[model samples]
Target: MPVEQAESLLASQFSIQHTYYRQHYPHGRFDIIMQGTKNIGRLYHDWSGDVVQLIDIALLSAYRGAGIGTRLMRAIVTEAARKHMRMQLYVEFDNPVRALYRTLGFAPAGENGIYELMHRDAMPFDEEAWASVRGLNNPFQ
Candidate 1:
């Protein structure tokens, strides 16, 4: 229950997850979310048949509300739109990020125990709409 022990356990869990993904999703992308010189989070996703599966995305506690996750999600949405593929992800029923996903056009598709499956259909990327989801003005508009 000590802080150090908890951190070590988390690191070990992450390592195990990374290894599992590497072996199972050989073609998937596992990206570190960087903020200038710091590694702030990670994103993992891959193609599942014709759908773009967002397997995981997590930010360090310090970076959770900084719009970084929103930006990364917008990029993924754009990519799925470009490929004309639906995007899907599973979120815990109580996760706050579920609101953001809904704002980005994902709808509740089903449920799996404690997780809810959400799906977003392929649509033309709307920069303005995405920006407004985080209450930001589109810089390029």
Candidate 2:
């Protein structure tokens, strides 16, 4: 196939998938991750159920490994803890971000094909930790 045609086909497929997700998870949120004025990545999640589900999160190659993902995950963990809600997400078996999720207290709950489901029970809120992760006194800020 011509390069242009292949690109168009892929783009349309992605659009279809995105639309399907939106319709399936009507309460899900999709946020663009930004740094200053540049778009760095995206975060998609749903908190409408008993469990806070982190559907997807990605950072640009230039923005990875800089603790941005850690901070974001921490924030979500803190909020879920505050609400006493369990958290869950699916990570590809080979995705390095699984380590970060493990560090944030998520453990392998199950598996489906190439994706491993990670779960973290609701935790007690810790103000100091939340503050630090939020850059209150954290160097990453």
Candidate 3:
């Protein structure tokens, strides 16, 4: 989706307030969606790279620990491999969800206070793949 269209949808879906929007990101926004309408969810992000972001993954109030989060993550992982893009997201160091991301193969690439920049690609991108992956990774390449 175009940046304008995505922000338009998330403006309501994410209940984004104008103040927060202007203060935090004066430049851009994102595209949000869920998994297959199975209640499993996914958010697509293009922050200089292609990634499927996880957001507001909700389980019924009574379904807190029947492995829902894990299942949803795995689904995203499977899809990611085919798309040939990685999964990226932020999680506070103490967030229980951080453990889950580790389980699904994400590693800390950078940080923001208590949060981390995490990503997963079965094969950590090589010189070529990395160049195409997100356009960063030059680490003197």
lDDT of 3 at 98: 78
In model 1, pairs of residues that clash are: none
Mind giving the per-residue lDDT tens digits that candidate 3 earns over 46-127?
3234665543344444545756556545655655665677777777788787787787688888999987888786443223
lDDT, candidate 2, at 91: 96
Q: CA shift at 97, candidate 3, in angstroms? A: 1.7
Show where candidate 1 strays beyond 4 Å.
1-4, 128-141
Residue 45 displacement (Å), model 3:
5.7
Q: Note the residue pairs that clash in candidate 3.
A: 35-41
Please list the Cα RMSD from the true structure of every candidate, rounded to 1 decimal place: 4.7, 4.3, 11.4
TM-score list, all predictions:
0.81, 0.81, 0.53
Note the Cα lDDT for every prediction shown.
0.81, 0.81, 0.54
lDDT of 1 by residue, 57-126 (tens): 8889998897778887886787678779999999999999999999889999999999999999988787
